[model samples]
Target: MAVEILIVDDDPLIRQTLHQQLVALGYSPHVAEDRRSAEQQLARQEFALVILDLALPDTSGLALLKHWQEAGTSLPTIMISGTATIPDAVEALKLGAADFLVKPVDMFLLEATLKRVLAAQALRSENTRLKQLTRGGRVDFLGDSPCIRELLAQAERVAATEQTVLVEGETGTGKQVLARWIHARSGRADEPLLAVNCAAITETLFESELFGHEKGAFTGAGERKPGKLELVGRGTLFLDEVGELPLLCQAKLLTAVEDRVFERVGGTRQMRFEGRIIAATNRILSQEIGKGGFRRDLYYRLSAFAMRLPALREHADDIPLYIGQALERCRRQYGRTFEPPDDNTLRQLKANSWPGNVRELYHHVERIALLTDGPRIPRSLWLSFPTEPESEPTDIPTGDLRTAMTGFKRKYIQRVLARCGGNQTEAARQLGIERTHLNHLLAEYDGRR
Candidate 1:
């Protein structure tokens, strides 16, 4: 990607010379003879830097600068003039011109100034990115559900091997927690566990984040920085929400996943990926592949040993355990404590479906703890907490049991589908029904829409 440089000057000779100079310096330069052409160019394209002759045929360069200022536009510009006075240079600088050069512009100085301004821009961009990106917190398992016990057993078996692992489930089902569990149990537990949030990263930053970049790879790249893949030596690279990875990155990652090797951005040197990859996603990749959103080859390569974490509702018996843990955490974090709920309160808590799984439960408990003044939280709060809505549709009559039963089944299936975020596969698994059966029922209910 060549850096675009816009040259606004009336001198054909100077424009041609500067164009050749910019090209020789590995830039793409566009020329405009006057202010009209310059404004047109600015409207049509994005330029990294603008070179403006102080004495344009139509207007003074300062007037163009004022136009930029009044239009609420701030373009990085370098002002050039054959007869540049000290006052003219000061005015250009005040108008946000990055630099002022006397005519017969020094190409070396131009290159150096370009690097300086671009480097400053990159630093500012990186600082802003760093502020936007936040590392997620980790929460380990703390439940006695048989579903979790089975998942643990499976994780242990997979942890013994060096094969890549993929964990799948609904949101808040402890996918990352399971990834951590696998990492801790694996042979490379001593090495650091590095992670990257696939969904949070912008596409431009994706490659540099995973495979690093050589110093001076791009205009503002500066010093070389090692990415997660390089940092997680012989350890685990936990790619969270990997289904959201951009197509370009998916192709880039295939080399690392399949060949166990990668190259830094703009560098020919190849590096071996000695670490294991444990990617987790809440998405159904099969559906994404059918929709052409995910690559089938990448999916196959990643799912060498795939596992699904059970939704919290599947293990309702563990609700008490989680509730108690949430209260204790609230105590530790905010110095708020509460009595253990009575059996009826426990029953109500268990009755509601926790659609967001353990994460939602913790937040719900914390909210109640923060607002309630007394040790005993009001039971009304528990009652108000959402439960699976009543599924009986009014159209069904009370006199006909067979027809009424059919309506109940349809409505119940619809409720469960909503709980599973409308994934027929997950909804079927949740309802303890075959996918074909769910599809068949959905076909009949489609007319009700």
Candidate 2:
């Protein structure tokens, strides 16, 4: 499609000249004579580029730009002036104007500026799309639920700012994923992202880990080593399981994160770092504060932009999609063909109240695939707490453990076929077996649910 250009100028000659130049370049051009006409055109049409004159008889172009910004109009506008001033150009740029062009505008220069601005907009759009699609490029996010969708949108908005995000979630709910997503979309994405698992570090090593240690500072210290704070300069530092931080370390960390400066362990020399701090916890921070487990002041600072990830049980509907993706990942890791759970197995998987959430479900699938024989994994591979009674054993003479195993497998095959809505392909995938082996199993068992 041809690019759409809007020319907003009071002078008919200037407008006509710009229109001709745009048309020569194969652009669809629209002309507006006055402020009212321009406003009307903007309301009715969508333009990729707007050539806006600074001085209008009825209203100033700068004023129009400000109005457009206030009204949430995102069209890229290039400001044109017959008498351009440094202040005017600065002000135009501050008001979200794309470019400032001095009058007697050269056609080539104008086209070049327009192309550059359009390319920038296109890049931004593409980045947004990729961020939205790739699990929001989240560190550990593993679900495709509506709750996660809304959380990603929130993350996008928060990332544009330098707010200290505090992610709160239950244990194993992937708080680190939310923190990484926030850092990934932030302005400091190019900078390093350093993480400190507070729960993993002891109180004795907390200070050294957070603040660099000078030579001979501790028993094992040989050379100077930078801490997480110093190492993450002009980037982001993630503190996971912050509730485990000791009081003294908490105070020091709070000061460093707030002031953007810190002193190394056993050293008095100060160091500065321009970066963002994102903290996460599995416990209720407010309750922790009341219980004297966390610092109130620090909590307020970290909670500037709070986000929570939904538990897997809350978004069980997304399990099938997650299973499919997880299975693909497993297949890649194990060098096996992808086989999704059959409908019956999927139903059973979804019905379970996943107390361990996504992490647990992943391990379960990986383990079951390893234990099951052939390509198809029958429902028997998974531990099912069925309420139905166990059938009495048939006493057949000359029966061995291998025969008993075959008979058990036959019954399990029948049960799975009964649950898979009669789709052989789905049944095979669910059993984690090859389609051919699944067909043989089904033939041996027949359709006896």
The parts of candidate 2 lying over 4 Å away from their true place are: 1-142, 383-449
Deviation of model 2 at 444, angstroms: 72
Q: List the residue pairs that clash in candidate 2.
A: 341-430, 342-430, 375-432, 375-433, 375-434, 376-431, 376-432, 376-433, 377-431, 377-432
Whole-model lDDT, candidate 2?
0.80
Tell me the whole-model lDDT of each prediction, alpha carbons only. 0.85, 0.80
lDDT of 1 by residue, 390-424 (tens): 89855755758887787788888988988888899
Candidate 1 vs. true structure, TM-score: 0.56
lDDT of 1: 0.85
Instruction: Identify the leading candidate in terms of TM-score.
Output: 1
TM-score per candidate, in order? 0.56, 0.54
Per-residue lDDT for 24 in model 1? 94
Per-residue lDDT tens digits for candidate 2, residues 1-449, read 99888999999999999989999978999999879999898889788879999999889999999999999987899999999799999999999999999988999998789877886676455444433433334454555678988888888899899888888887767777677777777787766677789989988888888887887887999756767776666677889999888888789878987787888887989889677888888888898997798999999888998888777888888888776676777777777755666787778788887777777777777776666542566667664432447787684434798877877787677667778977888878888899999887777667545
